[model samples]
Target: MLRYQWEDAVRFWNSKKGEDSERVGISSRQKQKFTHTAGSRSFASVAEAEEVKSGQKVGRLQLFEITHRKKDGSPMTSEAGEIMEKLKDKKAEYEATASTDSSVNLENIDNRIITEVLGPERYSRVRFQGSGVTLTQYFGSGSQQYMPSGSQAKAEVQRLRDQMAQMQANTVE
Candidate 1:
């Protein structure tokens, strides 16, 4: 995994590079901080977290901080509940639409789901949105694909659900 400085990420996103790169730096709005604490979530190891400091200009999605901690205090699972529901719906939809005439390859299935389920901004994380993917890779093709097993998938779904529940809990308070 590569360590990206928040300011550098901002510069990359803002398209201001090298000497031409504005010294003024990226605005906080354009950068997001990923931290860990109660009622918080982070998708990074302790070392990774240490590498990044708060108030640093991380990129749009370069850093993920879970707003809610698990029982063990880890990332809040990068999974999305709505996406899982949609995945179920998609599987059903595929079965329903499955036909002798219908020819759907893995790539086709993945692309369709990615396009429909995730809009432009959210679509970047193509792994969860797609049918099968190497979970390890961040939307990249690899030999050792990281497709989640049944238990792993279940855990992720549960984490997403718990996060939502926590958000709801916070909103109520």
Candidate 2:
């Protein structure tokens, strides 16, 4: 796959079965091609052009990059403690701004998987805040949750059908 057209041409020229001229090697053909490349260029100029640079050094400088990320497959380090601290602050702020009727529990959710996997420190940080960067922007506290594939579709469709039925009932009679 990596072989080039010039290589095949050179091979064909070298291995002519019926022809009987004194054989020409690929290097000689390449030399001739290089010599005849441009008008007004001679063999001496060609020899000078092929000269290797003197005292060349292939020196190198080492470089590396560090990465920070979260691991979730098996048991991993928890950010729960840091999360709880921030959540408490956010809850207080929300409570102050919200009207009396807002039903935000401001309580820790009891999830065995989260607690077991993350430990108290990290498990405490994860909560179902509204969708946005607000929950993750401060202190880099970002958490993503996933469930069965069809569950979301089923739930959304059920909710929409219920809403449509309610709207139709309101319009009737």
Please tell me which predicted candidate would have the highest TM-score against the true structure: 1
Cα-based lDDT for every prediction: 0.43, 0.35
How many residue pairs clash in model 1? 12
| lDDT of model number 1 | 0.43
TM-scores for every predicted model: 0.27, 0.17
* Ten contiguous residues minimizing lDDT sum, candidate 2: 59-68
TM-score of 1: 0.27
> What is candidate 1's lDDT per residue for 27-144, written digit by digit as tens?
5423533222432223334324434656454321222222223556454433433454565576566555444223322333444444455443242344222223233354346512
Clashes of each: 12, 4
Model 2, range 1-173, lDDT digits (tens) per residue?
A: 44798787667657754133434454465454111122354323333343333333211000000001123322112343333444445445545523442332322222222233334433233322212324245224434222212544464466569879999999994
